[model samples]
Target: MAARYLVSPRGGRRAYPDITSALRAAEARGRAALIEIAPGHYEEALTVRGEIRLAAAEGPGSVLVSRPRGAVLDAFGAVSVHGLTLAGRDAAVDIVGCHTGTLTLDRTEIRAHDGVAVHGRPHTSVTLRDSVVLYGRTVFTGSAGLIERCRFTDAANNAIAAIEGARVTVRGSRIEGSRIHGLRVCDAQAEIVGCEVTGTGQAAVVADTRGELAVTECAISATHAEGILFIEQSRGSVDRTTVTDALHGIVTKSGAGPVVRGSVFADCRDTGINVQDAGLGTFENCRVTHARNVAVFSTKGGAPEVRDCLVSGGNVGIAVTEGGRGRFARIGVEDLAGTALRVYDEASAAFEDVRVERCPAGLEARGNGGTTAEVTGAVFRDISLGAVAIDGQSRVTLRNVTAERGVMGFAVSGEAMLQVTDSEVAGVSGGGFAALGSGRLVARNITVTGSEGLGAFGTGSAYVDITDGTFTDCAVAASFDEKAAGRLVDCVVNGTSGVAVRHNGLVDLVSLRTSLPVVRHKEKPAAPPQIVQVLNNPVFNGPVFNGPVHDVQLAWNNGHVVQQQTEGDGTHP
Candidate 1:
């Protein structure tokens, strides 16, 4: 029959004086043992080689097991401790070796001085339920374990660390005041659900694994460093979590792919979410607020896809740099301190249905060497510097965009290329379109009105081709320098204070209608403007062609007409 050993502080019938005596008596019989301890403190160091169940005869706080120096229990076979307080200097419980050895703790409290509270080695597993660990570490290497409803405080290292192919599941747990990470998994697998980790010196939850780690419905805050870090070829998912008051809310690097869904990151010292160094991430329906730096940052080939996200009150809302590529759709950035969207370096992005409001400069793309951006259905309003700024050999295409109440609209400089279609730029303090320094712009079906400067201004070898456009109430409808080039076809210019077209370079005006004069080629003494081609066009207030006409069959006056010529030298159609 299985032995039942009773232990008490005082001498009694069928009772041993100490717990170690009862445990030794059961081990000698070679049978399963149940050792019930009474309500007092028993100081002992025990190593069990057989199956044993050590339970308190009374409730918790009644049975205290204290070892002044070393570990309290080392079990090589099956061991269970229920409703007992274990106090020691070294590890309170160490489960080692094979043969399916298991250690189970139910309603137990483990207190240690400078060592781990529980250590599980290879082939050993530990299970904790409704337990508390104080002033110690918990490490499981090459082992598997489960922790439920546990609280850990004042850990010297990580409160709970699983490494070297260990698998651990922690549910409804809390860890506080850990010097390092509150929970760390390295080269292993971990699943943390309904956990809260606060006041950690390093990352609250850090997993640098070759396997997977999952965290669900967790709150991590008050970390000295990043709140959560999943890096080094790890794959994971964090869902419905909130992180606050950290240097970085979440950081993913080194080829890690972590999916974060339905999360909120607020009051971060640095970026709310940082993806770097070939890491790929996906964020959906998330919100970031009050970040000191960029809200969403992707750098160094980190390609992130963000959808249905909102960023408010941050520096740069979304920044992609250093060969990074981002695909953002249906995102809104409001009240930003710097540029709402910034793409630089060799990075490229595609944005769809994005809105930026109350920012300094919205949608800035700079190519130090190579950068590109394609934006569709973008709306920018109440900006300080300009709505869209593209420079430095970059190429940007904006389709179905609207810019209102900005300093300037569509500022393209430094050999850049900008193509905008079906867009409107109105109520801008500066020119509606400013293309400078060898830049190229191809715009179609654009409307510009209520600008403080020229509706379209080109200078310094810039090339502009605007077709099917409307310009109203501008300083000048279109102005081009001597080195610039432009072609306006089928456009209507009305209610401008200055001349409709002030051309000093090569200009072609075809099928243009205006209440003001259609074309005025400046006859500068140094560099004269060339009206290259005026085909099938009527002018209302134009000076007659007084200079030497290249094509004598076409004459220009207030009401001009073309005369037919012979086919030998001059011809008119």
Candidate 2:
């Protein structure tokens, strides 16, 4: 059986004068004891060392236990506090486990003016339910605990901190107005579910230095810095969470690899998700919108795998720079003012099934050295500038790509190398494909239609090779100029208004079929037989071989016509 004791500030028959006297009497009884305190203010510190329960005679806010300094209640045994207000200048409640001690607080209010509200030491356990902690922090060091339906407001530091191997689970909590991080887990493990954390000074949640955290179904907003930060080799997962109005939504650095799934990040100032400094992360089924800078950025040797993600309304959609590498699949980028995807500065990326629409530029690869991008099954539509641009010693390969309704289709410049296979460019206002400034282009099985300018153009010492290509409805079908050199094998030009094939530089045409004539410019003389071979070409109008046509064998109505004009005349032969 349990013994019950009553305490009152005013003396009465069979009632103790103070709570200390009643506690002492209950301790001497040596059984489970309950000490009921009357509705009065007790200005004394208390320590519980036995199995005891402290309750208020009235309801909550009726009994006030206040201490000027130090902890108001120090519990070392199995202790329970119900419906009482504990206030202290240093700490409101301190639990130090002697032999796996436990403290339970139900429907209580704790106030700490300058220190922590609840502090649990090693090997202790705490269960706090329906409680409100104000003006302080709750810290667990090497302890395990559960906090349910609690409100921690106006915390001086982090509202909840678990460090030094502490394991904590917080459910149905509202942590608001923290001066520092809302929840911090360092070298510990924490699970946060169904919580709302708002107005944090720093990151809403942080896991650092081997700490593990799992956040699910939470709404974290209005953070000054990153909404969730994982650094120093920490690992975690965030599922089905929404983070909004932060400097950055999620940041992973220093070898941290966190798996984020089914999340939405919106209205961020900087990048929505940043993976840097050798960090690794997997983001799947995520949506990022209205970011000021890039939606997703991977840099400094970080390699992130992004799949089935949508990025909209950012300055740049995704950037892999500064030795970073990424693999992206099934990505959609739309409604941006700048380039949709950019890879540069010794970075490399592989993209599959990527679609970019309503952007200034689609995909850009520029670097000083050692940058590479491989794209397969990509589509670029409704673009203002070039759909794909490759520059500065970078190497890019595109297969099964389609560009429609763009200014230009593909532009390769500045010593770059581009290999395009099985591609189509349609409805472009400018040139379909261009290789300029000592660049190299190798295209196979390409089709160009409805281009207002030249279909295929090479200039400025560029080298172009096209095999089995078709150009239709272009002003000029193919033009090679300014010391450029290339070979066109088995190519056809149809419905061209201007000259079908105009050669101002070195070119070899083999088995070419054109509707209009082939014109060699008078500024540059034709090369020798091997360099300028017009072999087996069927022309509607006879070619105007202006200057020194060597090895020129034009077939007209299945008959060979070999003519040489060295005087640069406008005569057709």
lDDT of 2: 0.87
**What shift in Å separates residue 556 of candidate 2 from its native position after superposition?**
50
**Candidate 2: stretches off by over 4 Å:** 91-100, 496-498, 524-573
Kindly list the per-residue Cα lDDT of model 1 for residues 1-573, writing each as its tens digit. Answer: 557999998979999999888878988898898888999988887676678988989877788887777778787688888899988875434422122589888898888767778887877898989998888878878898899999999898899988999999999999999999998989988999999999999999988956578989999999999988888988889899999998899988888888999999998999998989987889999999989999999999998899999999979899999998899999999998899999999998899999999999999999865699999999998998899989999999999999999888898999899999999899987878878999999999999988878788889999999999899988788888868888999998988366688887487888888877655564543322244434435664433555766423333432554333344346631
lDDT value for model 1: 0.85
Q: Given candidate 2, what's the lDDT at residue 206?
A: 94
Worst 10 residues of 2 by lDDT: 91-100
Cα lDDT tens digits for candidate 2, 1-573: 668888898878788888788877877777888888899999877777688888998988899998887668878678888989988876434421223488888888888776678877789998889998887888889998799999989888899999999999999999898889889999999989989988899999999999999989889999989899999899999999999999999999999999999999999999898999998899999999988999999999999999999999979999999999899999999999899999999999999999999999999999976999999999999999988999999999999999998889988999999999999899998888889998999999999998888888899999989998999988888889888889899999988377788887498998999878888866745563432334445652444466775564445444444545554466643
Best by TM-score: 2
In angstroms, how far off is 54's CA in candidate 1? 2.1
lDDT of every model, 2 decimals: 0.85, 0.87
